[model samples]
Target: MTNPTVAELIARSNRLGADPANTNYAGGNTSAKGTETDPVTGEPVELLWVKGSGGDLGTLKPEGLAALRLDRLRALVDVYPGVEREDEMVAAFDYCLHGKGGAAPSIDTAMHGLVDAAHVDHLHPDSGIAIATAADGEELTGKIFGDKVVWVPWRRPGFQLGLDIAAIKRAHPAAIGCILGGHGITAWGDTSDEAEQNSLWIITTAQAYIDEHGTAAPFGAVRPGFEVLPEAERHAKAAALAATIRGLASTDKPMVGHYTDSAAVLEFLASEKAPALAELGTSCPDHFLRTKVKPMLLDLPADASVEASIARLIQLHEQYRADYAAYYQRHADDASPAMRGADPLIVLVPGVGMFSYGANKQTARVAGEFYVNAINVMRGAEALSSYRPIPESEKFRIEYWALEEAKLQRIPKAKTHQGRIAFVTGAASGIGKATAARLAAEGACVVIADLDLEKAQAAAAELGNTDVAIGVAANVADADGVQAAIDATLLAFGGIDLVVNNAGLSLSKPLLETTEKDWDLQHDVMAKGSFLVSRAAAKPLIEQGMGGDIIYISSKNSVFAGPNNIAYSATKADQAHQVRLLAVELGAHGVRVNGINPDGVVRGSGIFAGGWGAQRAATYGIKEEDLGQFYANRTILGREVVPSNVADAVYVLTGPELSRTTGLHVPVDSGVAAAFLR
Candidate 1:
């Protein structure tokens, strides 16, 4: 039987975690105390169910909660060593577990258990943290809450900080909660509703106080020529610069990127004090862990040309790397985890927006969101008083904490296509959609580019929303449409790492029956379409300096002399040579160009469904339904080929298995003897 209290706890946590104003993603925890029958003793025992380590309150569930014996948890204080050894207490939490398996306890478990309340919430709301990180936080707390809330000075979170809060609550019976200086807030109550209300009260009161007493322009006036650019120009500039920034960020390790042009980000970038405040960096641990201590600021005027701005960025990046290394060296001790990396996760550019990087898309997006929270905190802090953060040494201690290293090590190994971005043309259905799905499953971000916007978006949604895939409308035969698609890809995921030229139309016609229009239509959508898409995608691919893959979806018909397939076969033959041409030209840049020759992909193929299958069947004296079997019987392997077979070939060619093998054609026609490469 499940405990009602834990269920209510999860419900309360979800409510608190759902709003960005309440807290950033995965930035807070909630808990409830309940009674459960112990399996060994067969008796009712008090248990504390708290949001465990590395979980977001908004998505908390039963398994996400760590249940421990309240008696044992509270008893930890009796044997507590000093704050110097408080980390040992975290390890001790494992021993106090009441059941066989539960979520591993977080550093915050002590704060929830030690407090003598039935319910509690620890959140990093931007409004509350604004007061918390202000230089005069203690004074502000008194002025705003008037004794209803107290203030606790900066202390690294552990068993010690837990005891400090519990002591304050005992001493101030009238207080609902306390503001954690240079951190956030904590509230407690006899019931879940009361706890949530108290938390909301603190957040609302702090925000109202700031609004009443704050400066109209906390970041100072926007500098001349630094205002946000027009929407079209801003995105175009961002698209052009994303690859360069991503390349710099990936100096230490490859990173998936996310771009944000939110109002807050633009306003901050245009402010007079933006550079100085960004230099001081974020205060809250959660903020810095994601945004780094500070961002890599692109110090250039808003109107600077893209080439000049990129040159300046390159220079600034070299210095940023050096400064980061020095920061690590200044505080690192023998026990410290080897400097994780010198690369900055967040980059700020005037007139444009922000670029954030991480091992994956969600991580990168969340990092940007956290910086937005930090921006809000900075706005309020500077308005109330001067923005002040904890000492640099303290930040260093937290950044290099042994506990954080342990958590990182527990992350599972990355998938083969992890951190890769693949652009698949004509991905609304059939081979293109299947290829996109396969790449996404292996951890690549995919762009579903096709002439049909609605179907492309639907396919993208099916692959997994914007984080894993996006849809863009592109007529691959049109240069402008192709360029727009490439630009959209860069803005969505930083740069292109893989290109799949699979958009084609098929038409079966005999020597006399084939018209001039038939020849041009097939060539325009296939031969010229592949060329336009590849040429446009190649600019960013080369700009990123990350060497990428370009795979042309040609056909076995390119080699086999089949009757009444003149136009389609000729275009395929054109595409087949493009593979060899580009492979040689791009080899020096590490861009591998390859081709896939697949025959008889009748089932689920848009090209076949659109009259080509019927035409071919008529020529071969078989029904459209029997065309697949008829082609299969003609193949040496006697097997029917489907969209998935072509998709699998695409995966292998782009994967590490073929990392060194390029300028080659892999057949996916179940062994076509006549179509075999010479």
Candidate 2:
């Protein structure tokens, strides 16, 4: 039988975690105590169920809870080795499982199990953290909550801190929760509902107090030269600087990126106090872990030219890296894990916005979100009292902790396309859509660009939405449209690693019957479009200093000299030659240019469905429905080619298997001997 307590705990966690104000993502834990029948002995046993390590409360499930025997957990108190060897306690948790533990116990498990309350919640709410991080947090707690909440001074979260909180609870019988100095808040209740209400009250009350008492300028006055830029200009500047910033951030490894000009971010960056606050770094461990100890702030004024800003950024990054290495050296001991990397994860620019980087897009975006939480915390802290966080030494201890290193080691190996961003033109349907799906499945962040914005967004949504994919409208034939699409890609994912030039249409008329308009339109969309996309993407690819892939979806008609396909065949030929031309020109920069020559991709094909199938069937003297089989039967392998076939060819060419091969055309036409490269 399921324990009702665990179910209620899940509900409470979801309610708290669903709102950003309640806590930053995955930054808290919740627990419930209940009795369950042991399957082995048929004995009633008390168990503690708490949110497991690395689980996000908002999306938490039954499996996300770690179930431990309450008696066994409390027994460890007698053998507690003190704070210095606290990490070893984490290993001992495996022995305390109620049955097969539901999930791995987190460091916070001690706090939940040792407390007397039936339900408990530990949260990193921005408002609560604001009060918790204030310089006079103890004094502020008394002023705000009176006897309802008590103050617990700074202590790294471990077995000792858990014991301290338990002692605090016993001492203050009337206290429902306590604010941990330089951290967040912890609340408790005899019932699940009471626990949730207590947590919410603490959060809302802190916010209310700050609202009433906080000064008008929490972050100090907006600096004269750092005012937020106009919206259009702000975004344009962000797009322009994205590539250079991304390149600098990827100093350690290739990273996917995210850009935000949110009001909070813009306001903070434009304020006079931002530099000092950012330097103090974040108070909460969760904040600095994702955002790094602190962000690298650009010193240039908001109105500085892009070139000048980029130039200064180059110099600043070198200093930031050096300073980070020195800090690591200052704190690292013989036992500490190696320095992870010197690169900054979050970068702040006054007047523009913030850019964050990680191995993937979600990680990057979340880092940026965490920084915003920090920003809010700082705002409230400054308003209520002078902002004060834990010392730099404490932050260094948490950043390089051995237990944290173990967690990092447990993350699954990266997929083949991980950290790579792919841009697919005309990706809303047909071969382009199939290609986008394949790339995304293999862990590439995809941009589905098409003439139809609605279909493009729908396609992107199917591939996991903004986390791993985004949709953009691009009329590839127009230079402006193509450039805009490229800029959007940069803003969304930092830099491009792959470009698939697949946007095209066909007109199956003979040279004599093909109108001049038909010739120009086909050439404009295929030949000219491919060139424009390639040209626009090349600059960023080169600027990023990372090798890239450019694959063209040319047709078999490019080489087969097929009848009644003059306009389409010529455009494809133009694309095929571009592969060779660009391969030579870009080889020096490690950018590979390749082409996929597919024959008669009829089923589920946008071009075929849009009248090309009927026109081709008429020209071939065959029924439109039998055109696929007709083309298949003519091939040596007698296999009908589909969009996925072309997609497979694309994956193969860009994949590691063909890393050294470029300027080559691979056929997906089931043995088209005539179309085979000679």
Candidate 3:
């Protein structure tokens, strides 16, 4: 129906919004004009239901559609043309809202309301944006879409631009859509489905034309002979760079990584033409909005030390912000609002993969994904003679547009631990995993450091919030490995707010049966690993100057004597002492050191996995099924100690309740008389 209802419109919007290939992350909006009964007045009213600003259409619902009187919105067109104050124009849009506190209608609301169609879809598809941004974009669009699409020149998106679009529609009554040069495209139809398909057809048709005659990435393919470092080495280098850039950029809102270390990324970074082409603007205006006009590029020495790389990165970041300020001043006029934050969302290192940063991991990841897709779009445009992005002036206008700025300004402040970054060792499973998951739930971005990189990633994915959790590989006992893990934490999340030393293993043998290898393994993980990780994390904690937490997951064996567990008991005792010493040493810097001594946690425990469960059962002359019950009954509270229970105790040590308590131990063993803290 040409007069589509709001439900029909929302369904159509979600269909278009669901495909990121069709629209960037929440970058596009949609609208439909229909009739509805005014709830209060009981009269038929014509309304425009447009996608709410900041709400992604793919996930949009009816509530996300800001309803406004269609006639009232169209009437503003005549008045807005002469209005000098953009604030007054914004008030007009706000006044027309039929749903209070609903998403402010998109900046394109006026344009949508003016179009003579039952349904409208506006998006920045990858190929479509490339064509829109080309130097000969308007002429090329005419050739590809023929009579179906018209060309609309760029004007800051507002009442005036909407008027311009409406004029094109009036002149070309048969046109299905129009390309907004240097911005994006808009399509409309009598039916919602037709509108969306029209948008896609234009993109597909434009791409086919490029395939026949357009230039391919003119910079040439990534240089074949360049010295690309090993994958592990490149990851480490990228981690260092991400950490340094995040350190420089983060303040109250610490940046978290949506890090990608793929082969394609490495190729781009290693390209001989990177230093030149990378400096150019983004492939599409929406891409620019997410990644910023251009990434902050850092060129590290081929053999630079981690410390050297970080130092240079900080210096370069300072220059980048300064340049951003100058660029704003060059294009900003009296009407321009205060400059947006100068921190670069994308960081490009010459020989390493790109890193995307945001207030949280989700935003960072989405931005990172867009940048990756933009990479291909840019290459395509480059191949077609040369990729010509919009000028700096147009880029500035869109970036600082009131509507876009409002989206960011509306971001709710982080939770108590929202900006805090935590590194949890041995986070692949059991208590480590539980603790990591809990910390993320409470708002801390968590770095899962474990020997098994693959398992660690799986655990992070299970956490299901990509922006708040990341997995890194490291053997905590190795000094270099510990440092690398710490760097990964910094890379994934800009700073270290807490460190959880929960990685340890045991052979479960008596002193007489303990081999040198078994003893070494026990002491290396329980004692040495804790010592090294704490020492490595200390530098960044001290530098952050905001105070931090270091938690050691010790065991009841650290204090209570146990048969057939000498190596674990002895090494863990040393680990407990280390915590006390660190608490005393680091307390002055706002750092807190504590330990969680847990016992009888049989279910879902990494320590209980393998043949150890059967062995422990046999030690007590009981079947494996009875072992759990026996241990649960042995505790004074007669309760089972689960991984989540231990995780809760760890939180107590790190949370606000015990801020004044350090060098302390919380027993999460359901109450062991012999293992009492006293």
How many clashes show up per model? 0, 0, 9
lDDT of 1 by residue, 210-323 (tens): 999999999999999999999999999999999999999998899999999999999999999999999999988888988888899999988999999999999999999999
TM-score of 2: 0.99
Number of clashing residue pairs, candidate 1:
0
lDDT of 3: 0.78
Each model's C-alpha lDDT?
Answer: 0.93, 0.93, 0.78
Which consecutive 10 residues in model 2 have the weakest lDDT in total?
Answer: 94-103
lDDT, residue 389, candidate 2: 92
- Model 1 misses residue 160 by how many Å? 0.6
Measured with C-alpha atoms, the lDDT of residue 391 in candidate 1 is: 82
* lDDT string, candidate 3, 175-209, tens digits: 99988876678899888778878988887786777
TM-score of each: 0.99, 0.99, 0.83
Candidate 2 lDDT for residue 546? 82
For 1-678, candidate 2 gives per-residue lDDT tens digits of 467888899999999999999998989999999999999999999999999999999999999999999999999999899888989898988889977738889999999999899999999999999998999999999999999999999898888888999999999999999999999999999999999999999999999999999999999898899999998888888888888888899988888899989999999999999999989999899999999998999987899998999899999999999999999999999988888899999999999999999989999999999999999999999998989999999999889988889999999999889999999999999999999999998889999999999999999999995989999999999999999999999999988999999999988898899999999999999999999999999998888878899999998989999999889999999999999999999999899999999989888888999999999999999999999999999998999998999998888888889999989998888888898788
Between prediction 2 and prediction 3, the one with superior TM-score is 2
